[model samples]
Target: MARNDVDLLDLSLDELLTTTRTVRKRLDLTRPVPRALITECLEIAVQAPNGSNQQRWNWHVVDEPDLRAEVAEVYRSGMSGHQADPNRATRDIDYSTEEQQRIASSVAYLRDHLHKVPALLIPTVGGRMDEADIFLQASVWGSILPAVWNFMLALRARGLGSAWTTIHLHKEAEMAELLGIDAAKHTQVGLFPIAYTVGTEFGAGARQDLADLIRWNGAG
Candidate 1:
């Protein structure tokens, strides 16, 4: 597909939702992604409901070569020790050992090559929640996360892909300084690498049975 083309994938709601994979190795590094396409996705993204209708959010995009390289360096530094393994947090889940390895490999690949991705997006919301109460934290995150997911879905629809990554947050201060973001006034959500995928086809990922994972009513 041409960089300027806006031909979207013909996906139903469910297909769009289910197949929006966290792309890594598949990111098309050699091609350029049009800025207008990203703007179009953000247009859909901001439509997500936010707290009190106050859209105190900012989307920082780094497409310039030097800036993207610097940010990618910070991201690599943050993952220095973290990416040695797949997330231990998921160990308790039912994923097989092979699944874990596969995930870790893809993550490592992205970590090493993130600088080459076409664009990097960092979404921020107003105010810090470092010491805030659960209600406050929930309310704050509730506002921005929906929009981020919406953005991801919009990217999928437009033949682009990105992964929600927070490893860079370990060096959040460095990132903020580099990007000229005000750390005291806003919280950086996550880093998203935007690029057209090598292929548009994706399948649903593995998951535990819904019946086993879900709790109906008050049942545990």
Candidate 2:
């Protein structure tokens, strides 16, 4: 059996949790992510918190050239909407900072090169949630998100990087068709392009301070 625990005292658990940035342009598209590593990450991921211990995670890992191209096209087709949005075009103006500018430019780079990445992962679950009640919807997604987060964390620990992208979820059915997934039965959670980082020097990104966001009691 795979070990479920990492040695917190030996490993920089806090740093890993904090610095696993949403890697984009920095992902080394040229380097092939080893199949063993991907499997290892998934192994680690499956141990994440789930509802009723029912492990419902399903993965469609696209590594073949032809399928990658098709998936990328499908992802891009959906992305065109965001690309055409007026507000998105002016997002740089909304966040005027060197870091934000770098983020914007890198996002554009990924938009152009997503297909070329060494690996594309589509994480899914057994149930569809479109018409499900709030409880069912939350339970379904809640079971998957922790596993996905664990997968990302495992990848970062192994020097691999991937950005979780929801843009492709807009074309979920199309992607499901291409990947031979029965969309009626399974819900595609998101897309992730997996590759090595050009240089692994991640730092925490800016965020709202805990003090500002946290409240001692219920909403005022």
Candidate 3:
């Protein structure tokens, strides 16, 4: 009775969790995302677990046109390396030829139009990783990744969508200088373009077999 006493929000938890697609072409560039909604999602995000409960998460939300443009420019610049590799978009992907082309087109579209997305969310941690060993770096990243996932789940629940992007992090220092982030201290983990998706009817994408992915008793 104690568990039943609490009323949950009117949402399908299974559907919400699975259908929170990584939106690219379907991201509604024209729609304006309310700042308040983003704030609410982030409030949910901070509830995630972290190293020693350090709670070192900080979000840099850029909605200003000029700043978004600059961030988008830096983000798009990351594609240059991929340009040199002709098969970068289609290499070893699981999707079919048509699906692969569709994905490639969507990726290109998102890259070109990232500046027009309603909001740019950058998740950061309050520490640097330059000298950290692999295990230490894993701990550092482990602290923030859960919160970022929480943020994305919360956004999905609210009919918003975002892509988990790290290309821009390749230019993290330059971007930090542009955004006045103290690059020496904070590490920007990802660059996510957020918006109310054009339609909320999302579904799971193609993935490898669960049995193939599962490792029973450290079989791997």
Candidate 4:
């Protein structure tokens, strides 16, 4: 189908929600993601609101082979520590046997050739916050996360998929230098591999009921 003829509104809510999974193994690594599409998604993403209307977010897209390898190296160095951390490892949702194998294969592929993925998106925030100030830190992240998620949603609608991974930020300084990013001034919030999914169909994910997650006005 031609890009212009694609209708964003055609996607059902469930299709949007389910298909937007962290596409790792399913990423069509062999196919290339066009620059125009990435930019189109970003245009939609920036429409997401930020704190006090400060549109300080910036996105860096990496497509060169050399640069991708550098970023992948930095990510690998960090992944070891991140995977070792009990807190981090425990956070991943458990998968069924087939699903687990599929995810594991994808993760292994990423670990080995993340640099080969057609496009790498590094989302950044303009200002830095003191880590000691809890509220300030939260606000900084609050400003960028919404737009990032929106960017992912936009990609899904366009027949592309991405996974939010920060394993490379373990060596944020190295990654910043490799990408010519100023870590002190701008925070690289997350790294994602953007590409078309191998299959067009995606099902909804499992989650708890909203009532179970929400608290009553008086604390039941």
Candidate 5:
């Protein structure tokens, strides 16, 4: 069978990096995401390295109406506290007046209708690590972080957009029960909403120069 062709390497480093945005209100909530495409993306995700090659990762994709609603409820429930927090800031990233308005509008829309998005992905690990200290926590989470990133990159290359969200995990046990996630067996890492972006052209965001972040063996 002939396979579809596209130059993966041809995508400039900047383009690839810039396009991977944390999609929220810009997600095409009306369009449906086909299962086959999601499977293809996940196939790419598994190629990411796992700690000690354990390969013990699981992904749960929710598309059913009732389930999506349930997940959204969990997400909304978690978001309520943040929304109520007095210390939370509402500054916009875009500098222009119109751009700031647009950003604020998108955020408002997502907050209002997050439950209606097409799909949700909850990635999990097969085993739990003892939380003795920071190192132990890092060792367990380090295993899944790479694979999670690969999943997001694959989604971006395929014209999908997602945002890593742990807010819903605040009520992890409830979410687990609703999704039939075996929390006793697998560790739920985070939740992400997956959908085709309303637009594919995202610009590079502002970042500090490497010199400001990098350090030599000894501080100057």
Candidate 6:
């Protein structure tokens, strides 16, 4: 393949780092994301740091409309019990009421429209960590998360956007069957919706003062 379908946006490292928002409402659900572009991002993503360089990650990109619809149904089923209070998970966060409401609205929108997104990515690792010790769990997850984050960054650089979501994992077994994922052997990281952004303009998100969260040398 020629692999020239999309052009990578010219973004400095800092700009790329700060502006890759968790896109939900702004995702261009009507547009199609080429598999080659997803592969291009994965090529850059797998270069991320991992434990012992084992590289035991698998990237499952679902672009087929029927499959995507099935996955979205599973995601919806996972959220059905909680839709009445979508912001329940953020109740303890430090964000202001306005910020919280904004998050809730976006989350609700994604829940409703996830089936419309062009593609869904579910990255998995080699081992089952549900009963593992903290050390093993850390090693397993540490190996895949950076690569996933790298994939997200690469998506942002190419004008696509996604949000890391785990709501579907609540029904992981059902999802595994639907996708034929060997749950006994692999652990899913999260679900990501991939598509071009409605607009390419985004700004840094608000956060708490670093001074309040950072430490100098040791626990103060």
Best by lDDT: 1
What are the models' TM-scores?
Answer: 0.92, 0.88, 0.87, 0.86, 0.83, 0.92
Residue-level lDDT tens digits of model 5 in 53-84: 98888899999988888888888786776667
Kindly indicate the candidate among 3 and 5 with the higher TM-score.
Answer: 3
Model 6 worst lDDT run, 10 consecutive residues: 82-91
What are the per-residue Cα lDDT tens digits for candidate 6 across 43-117? 989999999999999988899999999999999987775555657684467656787879988988999999999
lDDT of 2: 0.84
Clashes of each: 0, 0, 0, 0, 0, 0
Error of 2 at 124 (Å): 0.5
Model 3: lDDT of residue 58: 82
How well does candidate 6 match the true structure in TM-score terms?
0.92
**Candidate 3 lowest-lDDT run of ten:** 1-10
Model 3 CA deviation exceeding 4 Å by range = 1-10, 85-96
> What is the C-alpha local distance difference test score of candidate 6?
0.90
lDDT of 1 by residue, 16-111 (tens): 999999999999999998889889889999999999989989999999999999999999988874546566354466546787778888988998
lDDT of 3 by residue, 96-131 (tens): 679777877888899999999999999899889999
Superposed on all Cα atoms, model 6 deviates from the true structure by an RMSD in Å of 2.5
Instruction: Candidate 2: give its CA RMSD in angstroms.
Output: 3.7
What would the per-residue lDDT of candidate 2 be over residues 1-220, giving only the tens digit for each residue? 2242322222389888988889888899788877777888899899999999899878889999888999999988878866677776455575577877787787778889988899999999999888899999999999999999999988888777899888887688898889999999999999999998887678887888888888777876
Query: Positional deviation of 9 in candidate 5, in angstroms?
Result: 11
